[model samples]
Target: MKTIFTAIFIILLLSACTKTLDIKLRSTEPKIVIQGNVTNSGGPYYIRINKTVDFDANNEYPPVVNATVSVLDSNTRRVDYYKYTGVNGYYISNNLFGQVGHTYKLTVTVDGETYTASSTMPNFVGINQLDFVQTKILNKTRILPQVTFTDPAYEKNYYVFSLAVNNVTYKAFYAVDDRLTDGNEMVQQLYMDSSYIQKRDFVTVILSSVDKNVYNYFNVLQANSGASPTTPSNPPSNISNGAYGYFGAEAVSMVSQSF
Candidate 1:
């Protein structure tokens, strides 16, 4: 009798698993996507503009062309104009260069719609040294780059790191806040998804001092890097007027090593 009851329960469970439900998804209107940055490294900064596409359409984002772009130095009240480069909605500024401790405001007008955003360049911080150490993960040995720096005292700070291997930029995002390590020496380990880096591969690491907003943007982006499109939400943007993506003014320092 007990065996018969067990068989009956199994059959009921199998029947429940065979049911399927169709889910209908609704489509929404597209919005603008803006990605712009100004670094303390140099001039000739570019901003890319595009419109978001439908959910089921190809991943091609239509470039927004003929848009007027300009940057303003908030302290000096000087505006520098940008010309559309006629390629992929990129706008280039010829005269404006990012300066540390200066605030920059970006203005964009497209098809009678306007968007604005602002970012302040943080103070420059240089990396003290860089080294590589070997470690075992998932039963495999991998060499990872490590960076050391002294965090400034009595101030809140945020940072972003990028790695380039063999002169090709890796898309991995690394961001950190000095909340815990403030006023102390910090040693950070940098990683990549692949473990195929050899001793002959050339590597470059960039350390950028960023504002709190940019730090939060990169934090959310890194958290949702490998998530499904339907499962994860978009990263928060600094751009106003219902736009997506971030505008950053950052102080950058870099170091390179062959490993």
Candidate 2:
């Protein structure tokens, strides 16, 4: 009986000595995030500028309004101004369209600080054909869409692909470089996690020719997408002046099919 009481008292003393650990996480200063893209497909390109928030805060990123945004064509020396649309953080271009082989520069000024990035529009490549096939992924049969295209010989090329199902766009980090398959006819399969595509669904695929910096940005972004937010590192950004995100000028092509 004395040994049992001693054991119980020792257990109670250990429990009383245990204290909860309250880890205080320090929040970093907010930085601007800019996501902008210009493609050969059409005009009215948009640039979104927002400020990063604390890790514990909501996902809403406050927009940075009243900023001066412009796009400059290096070859033609023409500057296109963007106007804030009061919708989200979007700024739309008035009369600028991306052209292949021309370099474009993005400039944004907010709170007396300026951020800049440059990207050249790459040449367009066509998708030869697209088809759907049944394949087993993760022990489940799925109808996957595949695309076939011929990479140009003796040239370095990078591509970004996006899919739309039934008019709803699904953006994935499906970026590829033709380093291994250079000058070869390649058939690439497209995949997504949700498996929402079905038979007779309207599908649209967009293929964009991107520059090296943009390709690297997407490569890191895809790699880090699955990681925990507590990780210290961040994805590479092309925008300078302590900003996050990327600015890309791409030559784009699209094809649609009813699966």
Candidate 3:
């Protein structure tokens, strides 16, 4: 009877220790996150990787590590691969970022797990007509440029417009307010009223490059909010880098007009 009792006690003690060990192992595993956006519409693009916070807790952005990006064009069958740059968990590539009609895909490996995503290049809506004129707001001089373009209207589409002035060395400032279409309020205001102003001597406007996913997000928002950009419930933080930066995407837009 004594031997049996001792054996039972040993088994119970081992079971309790095993549970504790499992909890400790879970705590030590790394918490990581990864996100990316096209910084420029030009050939060279950057994939930004970052880590998310612990379960609903606020945490600083953590850059991703050891991630690789491979791009293949559907029509060209051309392949390009990018290696992670040590700066801010970014992968840099000059030749593989995007092309007018090509499809792009991304795959990531982290923590012994693999994640995959793909996006097709949004149609490049060249600006057939662009101009900037003077206007006044609040009795103060505010430079505004009015842009017009025909929507290609794909099955699912998203668009971003970028402006560059002077040359590649210098940048110009302006805002789209929202997407453009026929006879919308913002578009109407841009044309009928003297609301448009010129901020610079000339500026080049190009359509923004986005995948079908982001396009669907904005398209739905536009249908609900009209052409006006909605008021932000939670404004962005001091961090000024991501997709929301001043000139978030590339400016390789070839369309240009002189004031």
Candidate 4:
């Protein structure tokens, strides 16, 4: 999925060189944004709880403290809990799980209401190679990262790849599913603004194998935030109790490239 900022940049730059947009965001009642994830890479994984801010307000997310959170392993029937770091709405898990085919359930109780989500860790898929290839976007030549991986056959698979430059992760995530090209040697190109890519910059690409629910959440989010995004609508959340954000369990493969 292209990031909102980078996608907007491509849309404007490729279309008319420059354009103006006037978006008026309406104020809505504050809702909590609870996001958490578990990876096969291991833990103490993180969970963040925050409330959405007003449109006219400063760009700040108010943290939701005093919430009780837990991650339970369905396979082992053991429970792993979390502790708030006392800032930034961050909660770190203890005794995390990394086993495949295990379902994990996350429970967060806030203000006497409980919100929950569950995810199962899929089988692992590793990146074969990483390459920086030149491509054209709307007649503009741009160098983008290409990842090579062998897609597994027979099962439905979904993926999300995220990029980080010099240890700073970009907010834009790329999500794709094995629809027509299942069981093929796939070369997926990551499209983003690469103007700041300098010589010898460390680049990291993480490919996540996610469940269908988690995939849908990010797929709709990616769609709504694409170039020439349509009327804004909320992305589907897997969390119960009407919360915003997602709780995901992913089996990930990571590859890094320099220069």
lDDT of 4 by residue, 1-259 (tens): 2364454343222221111112212337787778778887766577878877676666577788899999999989989889986656777777885677899899999999899999998888899999998777778776677899988999889987777777665556677999987999888987785444567888888888899988887787677666443355666789998888888888887788897
Candidate 2 per-residue lDDT over residues 1-259, each given as its tens digit: 5664344333212211111111112237778888877777666677878887776776577888889999999999999999986766767789996789999999999999999999998888988998887888778888877888989999999987777777555546478999999999988888877665687998877777899998887776666556665663565779998888889888776778998
Q: Tens digits of per-residue lDDT for model 3 on 18-113?
A: 000000011122443333443224444455556544333433455677666555555677766767756655565557544555555555556565
| Tens-digit lDDT track of model 1 for 1-259 | 5664344333212211100111111225678877777887776677778887766666677788878999898978889998876666667777887889999999999899999999998988889998888888889999888999888888999998877777656667588989999899988898778654687888777888889988887887777666665655666779999887778888887788888
**Candidate 4 accuracy as TM-score:** 0.85
TM-score (C-alpha) between model 1 and the true structure? 0.86
Higher-ranked by TM-score: 3 or 4: 4
TM-score of each: 0.86, 0.86, 0.53, 0.85
Q: Whole-model lDDT, candidate 2?
A: 0.75
Clashing residue pairs, candidate 4?
A: 1-174, 1-175
Lowest lDDT 10-mer window, candidate 1? 15-24
User: Comparing 2 and 4 by lDDT, which wins?
Assistant: 2
Clashes of each: 1, 1, 6, 2
Q: Which has the better lDDT: candidate 3, or candidate 4?
A: 4
Q: Which stretches of candidate 3 lie over 4 Å from their true place?
A: 1-42, 53-60, 74-78, 94-97, 139-141, 153-157, 164-204, 209-211, 217-259
Report the C-alpha displacement of residue 109, candidate 2, in angstroms.
0.3
